[model samples]
Target: MIWSVISLLMPFNLEVMVNQGYLAERSGYWGFLLQHPLNSLFEGGLVHLWFLPALMIAVAIMALLIRQQKTHWMLPIAIGLYLYGEFAGSSAVVTGMSAPIYTRNGPFFSTLFVVVGYLIRERHILWQSRSALLLAMLGMAFHFVEAYGLHQYGQVFNTNDYLFGTTLWAIGLFLFLLAKPDLGRKPWGFSLSQSILGFYVSHLLVVIMMMNLARFLGLAGLEKDTLVLFGTLLTTYLLVKGLERTPLKHLLFR
Candidate 1:
């Protein structure tokens, strides 16, 4: 939260940065910072912060269910909720209502994945098997097909679609990782993991800055994107490593 707030206070504005021609309408730094707490709390705020609150809610719900010895029912209930979300999206055509409500409703939309994670952890499900790999591949293929179908129908593809096949893909990939014995033993693994949160919070600002720099240098398309990605990653990694040894680490990362 602290990192997110600090990032939002930066001069960079994603809304203006992306719009390019609308830079004149960008909010002043103080105004943007003041408005961001509300936006962050309600509208996901600063790119990826939505995952934090969404995960919080999902984890709370899972904790309550587990505490009540309702673990067996959790997965089934989550599946049913996911299916309802999907149906709600489809029904938008007939009801004249928005189809992607579930996506926007972070708590509800995030529950299924949270439940899946809990089930996997509690059951000690392993993903190293050949069957799991094949299933994961199939799930990814199905996710693409579903996404394409949604695009063809002129409806926005949202989280419900992801919940369908993407969920399976994630499960398979997660299991596959679990099946591996030496996945996190790399020399840089500890530093990388420690710095990951900082990277997540800071990378968007770096990307925005790098993209603008790229454009100013006459770069375009893939060249711009590649530069932005690599530049952001390198800068964020260094920033996190530097901060890790400083007094500000607690304020920024803890």
Candidate 2:
């Protein structure tokens, strides 16, 4: 939930859509349900990205209510909701801004994340080294190929989509490491709350600052987006580290 909030606050699609006032006016009951500035961009002006969060919430509630009724419907309803959002016209176009290459595929990919996470939790088959390595390699290879396509052909893909899959692998590794008696059961230790929060909230700001600095230094044409991205990430890491060492960590992270 906190990550969701951070995703919302990040200087991404939501901010732009709101500024354009595109989300305030949408079509259908689903649009109404997702009628936030952000929703306008996700729903493709009718309700794209905005609908996903609502669907997630609605599915969760409905799943609980219908737990005794029937469970098969839960997966179907969730899948349907995600597909409706991704394959739909407007939102598909809108997703390109952040995850350009995978906009059309976002629903499929995002739905996979949710389903996989649920299965992992439900089955308690948290981690196995071979499975983790296989999944991570497959995901990374696909992302690398897609990224290359985007770079060479001017296609767009979502970096976050790749990140999501990789994060899953990280969590799996963490789980595996935690299960080892020598590593200690410390899944929540080391406190990623501050660093993750700082990165999600201020990483874009760091990017903007880096770009402007590069431009002001008359290195505009020479500056690469990858460098800016790396620099921003590094700055974020340092900033988060500093924050964690400060008393204000609680105010920011907690």
Best prediction by TM-score? 1
Question: What are the per-residue Cα lDDT tens digits for candidate 1 across 173-233?
Answer: 7777778758788878975887877777767777878976886788998998889889888
TM-score quality measure for candidate 1: 0.79
- Candidate 1 clash pair list: 127-175
Count of backbone collisions in candidate 2: 13
Candidate 2 least-lDDT 10 residues: 42-51
> Looking at candidate 2, what is the lDDT of residue 225?
68
- List TM-score per model, in order: 0.79, 0.49
| Candidate 1, superposed: residue stretches over 4 Å from native | 13-42, 87-105, 156-163
Where in model 2 is the C-alpha error above 4 Å? 1-72, 89-112, 126-128, 135-194, 221-230, 244-251
TM-score of 2: 0.49
